[model samples]
Target: MTDVFAGVRLLGPPETDGEYIALSEHETVHLHEYTRIYAVPGLYEHVVQERLRCTSPQVAAAGFLRAAATLGLEPDSMTVLDVGAGTGLVGELVRHGGVGRVVGVDALAAARAASLRDRPGVYAGYVVGDFLHADELREALRPYALGGLVSAGAFGGTHATPQALRNALAVLSSGAPVAFTIDERWMDASDPDGFGAAVEQLVADGRLDVLERTRFQHRVTTTGEPVFYQLVVGRTG
Candidate 1:
């Protein structure tokens, strides 16, 4: 197979993400450039998965299974929701992990398109709407009986907020398995409105019961520097 990354160049370190690939010799894009990145077929997979060696997808999928096992629950009848659902990478992983059904939710329509193009049939259904405030989105997802939630590289930074997490949990069945990964910097920050505080508040309020929290290298930066993120496993109250 030919190397797709051969045409790409490293621009430098991204602020928080572990990727920093250039479109051309002189044109670099931030990770937030989703439209540009997702527009190109195989670009995201090559840059983020192959080149950067991202592992959050696998980690989050495995974490979900671990959470289920810890809860003495089986996946035979569970339906999982993959938040972010970019290109269906995480969704595909969870599906192969034995989750009977996996629905995807992403705010970007382009993401949904890319997933269909690159990884068709991975998601039982893909919904594009805001998890935080889309009133109609809740109804749209209700048919899936969202009993489990899993995500990787879809929280923190310019991605899903902690409130989004809460809103998602609100619709899930009680004691639904939940697993996700967030950058360590975002997970440890003391900002009152940050994920750290939000999660603390969730656990304190008995909304989310955390089961396991561990840190690992999510991926490597353009300069080959390790970037760490925390995998959080829990269940809704």
Candidate 2:
């Protein structure tokens, strides 16, 4: 059987740092353009997962599960807040990992719509609001008593900013597990985004405790070059 997105074409290389393409009957868009991509069922998976082989969701979930296990936390008893939960991919994986409840947060309505269409019932609750400024969402999530935060492939580029991470942490209970994956370059000292510095300062200030850090292939670029990402699992202090 022919794939739904078999006609989609991606162009660009790892050096470009992002992929761009015009799918059949669609406008040209970048690979990280979640709103547009999610509007079309199977397109995001075909481009990012099937073609590029992105495994960030699995990597982040594995690290979180392992950390939770080491901390004597039962996955089936934990409620996790999935930041930047594009199309509910990470939420689905985390839920399957036995998390009792999964809440998804993203800035795009298209993402929420897509998640409902593609992975219905995966997230106990899905919020369509920016993590940085969505006070209502923060309040809505309060009822969930989130015990952990998990984000995959949503920290770098035009996705969630460092401040978004802080906002996400604010909603979780103290000492909750936090896990995420980002391009290694985002953590470089030279990167102007200051994500690395922000995280380091959080640790230095005793606000977060580092548990595990692993580097792995996040995916391959359209040019077939490997893109490396770092998975970080920690606990809010």
- Please list the C-alpha lDDT of all candidates, in the order they appear: 0.86, 0.83
Mark the 10 consecutive residues where model 2 has the least summed lDDT: 1-10
lDDT of 2 by residue, 1-237 (tens): 136666777787446455786687656787767787888877787778778899998999888888798888998998898888888888988888899999898888999999999999999898888876858778878678889999997776677788877777778777888899988888875654667877887888887888987799999877788999989899998
State the lDDT of candidate 1 residue by residue for 1-237, as single tens digits: 126657886667646564566788778887568888999898888888887889999999999999998998888778899988989888888778788889999999999999999999888899998877757789899778888899897878778787787787787888999999999888865898788888898899998999999999999877888999999999998
lDDT of 2 at 176: 86
Angstrom error at residue 100, model 2: 0.7
Clashing pairs in 2: none
Q: RMSD of each candidate?
A: 2.2, 2.1
Provide the global lDDT of candidate 2 against the true structure: 0.83
In candidate 1, residue 95 scores what lDDT?
Answer: 77
